[model samples]
Target chain A: MSTFMQFITTGLRLGSVYALIALGYTMVYGIIKLINFAHGDFIMVGGYTLFFTIPAFMKLGLPGWAAVFIAIIVCAVVGMLVELLAYRPVRKRGNNLTSLITAIAMSFILENLAQAIPAIGPDPRVPYMLFNNDIKIGSFSISVATLITIVVSAIIMIGLYQFTQKTKIGRAMRCVSEDKQAAVLMGINVNKVIIITFAIGAGLAAVAALMYIAQYPKVTTTMGATLGIYAFVSAVLGGIGSLPGAMLGGIIIGIVQSGTSTYISSSMADTFVYLILIVVLMVKPAGILGKNIGEKV
Target chain B: MLNIKDLCVSYGAISALKGISLTVNDGELVTLIGANGAGKTTTLHTISGLLKASSGTIMLDDIDLQKTPAHKIIEYGMAQVPEGRHVFAQMTVLENLYMGAYSISDKKKIEDNIEWVFHHFPRLKERSKQLAGTLSGGEQQMLATGRAIMTNPKIVLMDEPSMGLSPLLVSEIFSIIKELQKSGITILLVEQNAKMALSIADRAYVLENGKISMSGNASELLNDERVKKAYLGA
Candidate 1:
């Protein structure tokens, strides 16, 4: 029973990472109706940012918390750069083909760039371990850092929800998502909203990456590639445009992986995940939270 | 007051709004009627800052609306209810209405405006928590109008509000529009249903292939044989 609890707790902890990464996918898909395949590379960039941030953090004699703050900021800027350079110019109609190719190219570019650099090339590993052992709660155990990350992830989601619900910028983003022409007629700057969407999505990715390496204690050029694919799967599982769905999908996927790995072959955990996804898709193509989308007649 | 002078809007090589001139006095409800692709919507789009005027001036009171960005046009007190009742489908009715007052920063004023929207759309009040996608077509139209009114603009532009509605709902929507005008809000209505639109309009313009072919009092244009054959389907 304790072992089962441990698996569940650990699954929930990893679920937070998937949830954060999934949000980036959902938000971009909601706003622009585009799948930013390069989003995973954005996560990789964020991880590297955290890596470089440690030396500066130590030089300033800052505590561990301060280092995280610096890392998040740097990662956010890197995300914005990806948007300005890679995504902005190809936003016109009928540019989806080029954009898709561009996104794939960008994903590989970020990965290869890290591989080419001597310091980070080939393989990357965390220089220091930031997390202590699990904190126990009634025999269910979870790491302190993982617990903090899960809590922080929830707070970020809440912040995102509030912004989308309460602010003008948020309203504009929704309007654009619903109908770009109508949004334009209502005096909304669609371009600005799209840029902001990319920024926020990138920022979330950065936070997720920071937590990711803190627990795993390793980083590499090719990091976040498989994880990025899974995050996209989570977004689809939940409903690509629905925020809550993304998080819920993440938790479900995490639970399946952890649950299966515990009782079955750990090496076949990925197969179980894919099997679940296939079954879920066959049952409901729009996803658990995703409604069937249609255009106004 | 609004003045659109010598406005010409083109989509690629095809002109959607030719060199057209028109004037609307303060506190006047005007309608533009035509068949599909007759440029009724284009005129409104250009005036509302959604589309740029290739060569023209769109003046509202003392300001040149043609030069302002689409996002800032609402600051000049003009709001548009786009074609087909374009409410944010995923948002709750209350959230949809609140989006209309996005530029109005005063919290109290925004609240009062929301209350006023609820008052104008009492049905919306009962369904405020409901997702806009779930509403009936008529209700969505009402919500769209209510959302536009929340801006408290001097003028509201609507494109085809009566489309895709039952006759009863059509009458219902038109009466509410009339009540809005009676309460002293200028309206720019673009429609394919010329007869219904002209009945409530103070003045009317007939757009033909991107140019104003006829302009006069609503009653006079309603009686015009050309309008009768082309738009009224008489």
Candidate 2:
């Protein structure tokens, strides 16, 4: 039972991180129908930013929380730049194959650029520990860092839900997502909404990165590649464009991964994750939360 | 006031609008009557900034609408009820109406506009909380018109408001449109139901194969022998 509790806590911690990153993927895909392959790179950028800046902020007598805020802002700007520079030019043509290729290229550029830059190099660096304390309850015990991650993830998710429902820009996002041409007729600046969607997704990804680095304590230029793909799988598992689905899929993937690593074999964890994806797809092609929307003739 | 001159549009070698010229005076409800593929929809699309004119000038008051983007065109006080009542299907009727007032930021004004829309289409008010996709055909058309009017546009470009509706619903929608015009909203209506459109419009233009084949007062065109043979089937 104690071992089970340990795995559950670990799963929840990992799930929150995956859910955050998955949101970035789901949102960008939801709005523009672009998979945004480079979205995962935002995680690496955030991890590196956190690794370098948190210590510097500590030296300057600033709190660790300030570093998280700074990383989120920087990563958001980077995401917007990716959209403006890479995606915006080809957007007018509305060609899927070109956009898909652009996304893949963006992924490689960020990975290679990070590796080439001496300051950020390919070497892995351990992040400064944010919470060394642990919370205990009878037989179950968990790290304060993990608790913070779960709570922060929940808060961010709830805030996002409210923002989508209440704000004017949020309504515009929904309108654009539903019908781009109709939205245009309604006076919505579709490009602006797309940019903002990328910004918000990347911002959330930064928060996920901070949580992930804090738990794993390692940052590398290539980290985003695998982690990003896994989070994307989680997004698909839950329902690519559905917010609640992303969260649910991330948790399910996290639990499954932890279960495989703990009971089965750590080496075969990814294989099993992909297996789950295949099974889910075979049963319900639209993911768990997504409804089938047939195109009107 | 709207003035379109020598407008030409093409879809990669297929000319959709070929040098069509027309004027919609302020407060006038002008209908563009034509069959399918007659450039009626294209003309409205060009005026609403959906399609860029290959060579033409669309002047709305002092601003050149031809140069504007589709989104910013509404800022110049033009709104379009696109064909098929393209309401945001996944959204609730209330949310759909809020989208109509997308450019307006003042909270009070948006609420007021929504209230005003509900007053015009009280059925929409009852279904305000319901998803727009579930509404019947006639209700969807009403919601579409209500949404367009929610913007308080200077000129509402309506594309086939009576499309895919029963005869009863057709007359119902046209009457509501007439009432909207009576309330001082300028209208540029496009319709394949030429008989109903011509009967209500102050002036009308006949489009055939991407060009304006005829233009005159609505009643005169309604009585013309050529219009009777071709459109009215008299």
lDDT of each: 0.83, 0.90
Candidate 2 lDDT over A254-287, as tens digits, reads 8888888888888988898999999998999989
The deviation in Å at residue B113 for candidate 2 is: 2.1
Task: For each candidate, report its DockQ versus the true two-chain complex.
Answer: 0.53, 0.72
Candidate 2 wrongly placed segments (more than 4 Å): A294-297
What DockQ results for candidate 2? 0.72
Fold similarity of candidate 2's chain A to the true chain A, as a TM-score: 0.97
Q: Provide chain B TM-scores across all predictions.
A: 0.97, 0.98
- Across residues B78-167, which tens digit of lDDT does each residue of candidate 2 receive? 888999889988889998898898888788988998888888899999999998888888998998899898778999999999998989
Candidate with top TM-score is: 2
Model 1 CA lDDT for position A157: 85
The per-prediction i-RMS, to one decimal, reads 2.0, 1.9
Candidate with top DockQ is 2
In candidate 1 chain B, what residue range of length 10 has the lowest lDDT sum?
B96-105
